[model samples]
Target chain A: EAGVAQSPRYKIIEKRQSVAFWCNPISGHATLYWYQQILGQGPKLLIQFQNNGVVDDSQLPKDRFSAERLKGVDSTLKIQPAKLEDSAVYLCASSGEGSGNTIYFGEGSWLTVV
Target chain B: SQKIEQNSEALNIQEGKTATLTCNYTNYSPAYLQWYRQDPGRGPVFLLLIRENEKEKRKERLKVTFDTTLKQSLFHITASQPADSATYLCALGLDRGSTLGRLYFGRGTQLTVWP
Candidate 1:
């Protein structure tokens, strides 16, 4: 079966510019997540979507980061007025219903804010 | 909030030897824990999962042991290989109400097996 799919494997933007990453999860998976992984650190969850509804987004910086999973299949994560500190890999992952947290991840979208 | 800790630095060993990694968590005892393998610049791949009730679980040459008393988990790879070199991450599944099954990760342990 095909794994999670992400776009723009790499991205670069100015500090004040905006950037967005897209994701297409595995077929039939109902749970989708976006995580930010900095160098030398584990993936930190930014948001989670169960179907089209948000399950959790406590860690996301609402002032800058926004994500949407329209129709519950495709998701987009956006970072506006990007900061130099926003440079990191944006990883999209998915898990099927009743999978019990066994998430499968995409390769990731690398972002470098200059 | 749960704080998870993995082997803090890189572990290097010769090929054909066994490599063991540790993960410790402070606070509540998770109902289940998971391990993942992440290569440089890539996303993590699911490796294994061990439940609170399960003392040990194995797959091929990989084995995982969970000890609730010590609040730790041990991951072992037998007959290590160069291809096994990567960052290994341990995740705790938070079993709260709306956040049930949410995962929190530890700083991974980098393991390198040289020929």
Candidate 2:
């Protein structure tokens, strides 16, 4: 089976600019997630969507970051007025309907804000 | 808040040897734990999961042991190879009356196996 798919494997943006990353999860997956991985750190969840409805977004920076899963199959994460600290890898992952199921991740979109 | 920690120092082992990584968590009781392998510039790939009731789980040459008393998990890779070199992450799943619980991940342990 095909794994999660992501776009723009790499992205470079200037501070104050805006950037977006796209993701297509595995077929039939019911849960989608966006995580930000800074250097030398684990993936920090930015948001989670369960069938287009948000499950959790407590860690997300609402002032600068936004994400949406329109049909519950694909998702987009956007960051406006990007800062140098925003430089990191944006990883998209998906899982089946149960808590025990393993989550599969995409290659991730690398973002470098200069 | 829950806090997870893995070894910050990189582990170096010779090929064919066994490599063990440790993960510890505090301030939370997780129902399950998961392990993942991540390579440079790539997202993490699922490796294994061990439930709270399960003391140990194995898949091929990989073994995971969870100890609730200590609130720690240990991941072991046997017959290690150079290809096994990567960052290994441990995630704690805390249930909240949902089929899928939220995951809190550790910083990860980097393992380097040399031939």
Candidate 3:
């Protein structure tokens, strides 16, 4: 079985610019998540989607960050007016329905904002 | 407000020895906990899961013990190997109205095995 997939394994952007990351979860998975991993820290969940409906997004920076999972298969995370502090790895994860939190993560998209 | 913590520093161990890591949480009464292995520059991979009622769970060479009373979880690897070197993370499944499980992860503890 294929694992979670992410695009642009690496991304470089300038402060004040815009950047977006994409994720393709495993087949038949209904729960999708986006996490931000800053250096020297664990991945922090930014948003979660359950079949195209957002279940949680309490940690996301609504002022600058947004995410969408249209149709609930793939997801996209976007950051506008990126700041230098935004530099980090963006990881996408997925799990099946009622799986009890056994999430599978993607390789992640490394973002460096200069 | 829940907080999860793992060792912030890396653990260096000799090959063929056993490696053990600890995770502690505060202000959370999780129903289940999970462990994941993450390599540098990669996403974390699922390792094992242990519920509140389960004291221990094991895979080939990996074992996890969860103690809810202590609010701690321990991850152990037997017969350590160089390939086993990676960061290990502990996650707590938050109860949010029976919604799909949402996890809160710790910073992770890096383990390095030397031959």
Candidate 4:
């Protein structure tokens, strides 16, 4: 079975520019999540979606960050007016229905903001 | 605020020896803890999950122990190999009922196995 897929494995952008990353979760997975991992740090949850509806996005920066899971299978995360501090690996993950279940993650999209 | 911590030091062990990594957390109660392995330039892969009600869980050569009172979990890989050299991450599932499945992760520990 194929794992989660992400687009543009690496991206470079200027401080004021905008960037976007895409993710395709595993087949039949209902829970999708977006996380940002700074260098030398663990991943921080940015948003989560269950199907076409958002489950949690308390950590997302509304001013610059936005994400949508259209059709409940593919997702896109966007950061407008990116800052240098936004340089990090954007990771996407998916899971089934339970909290104790295993979650599958994509290779991640690495962003470097200048 | 809830916090998760893992050993920042790189664990070096012989290829045939067992490798043990530690994860500890403070504040907030978690219903389950999970372990994941990550290679450089890659995302984490799920390794194991242990619930608070369960004291131990094993998957082949991998074993996990959870101590809720101490707020700690230990991951052990027996007969370790060089291929097992990677960053190990621990995560806690924040429960708010209905299994929303939000996880808080720890800074992973790097492991190296010597031949």
Q: TM-score of chain A, model 3?
A: 0.96
Candidate 4 per-residue lDDT over residues A1-114, each given as its tens digit: 789999989999989999999999988888999999999988989999989899899999999999999899999999999999999999999987543488889999999999
- The A-chain TM-scores of all the candidates are 0.96, 0.96, 0.96, 0.96
- Over 4 Å off in model 2, which ranges? A98-100, B96-98
User: Per-residue lDDT for A39 in model 1?
Assistant: 88
Candidate number that wins on DockQ, 1 or 2: 2
Residues A1-114 of candidate 1 have per-residue lDDT tens digits of 899999999998999899999999999998899999998888999999999999889999999999999899999999998999999999999998655557999999999999
List TM-scores of chain B, every candidate.
Answer: 0.93, 0.94, 0.93, 0.94
Candidate 2's error at A111, in angstroms?
0.6
Ordered from best to worst TM-score, the candidate numbers read 4, 2, 1, 3
What's the C-alpha lDDT at position B54 in model 2?
Answer: 94
- What's model 2's lDDT at B111? 95
**Candidate 1 CAPRI grade:** medium
lDDT of each residue in A33-67, candidate 2, tens digit only? 99899999889889999989999999999999999
Candidate 4: stretches off by over 4 Å: A97-100, B96-100
Q: Write the per-residue lDDT of candidate 4 for residues B3-107, one digit (tens) a residue.
A: 888976589999999999999999969899999999999999999989889999999999999999999999999999999999999999878466447789999
Q: How does model 3 score by TM-score?
A: 0.94
Instruction: Please give the RMSD of candidate 2 to the true structure.
Output: 1.5
What is candidate 4's DockQ?
A: 0.78
Query: Global lDDT for candidate 4?
Result: 0.92
lDDT of each: 0.92, 0.91, 0.90, 0.92
Candidate 2 lDDT tens digits, B1-115: 7689897659999999999999999997998999999999789999999989999999999999999999999999999999999999999888745556468888899999999
On a 0 to 100 scale, what is the lDDT of residue A36 in model 4? 96
Show the colliding residue pairs in model 1: none
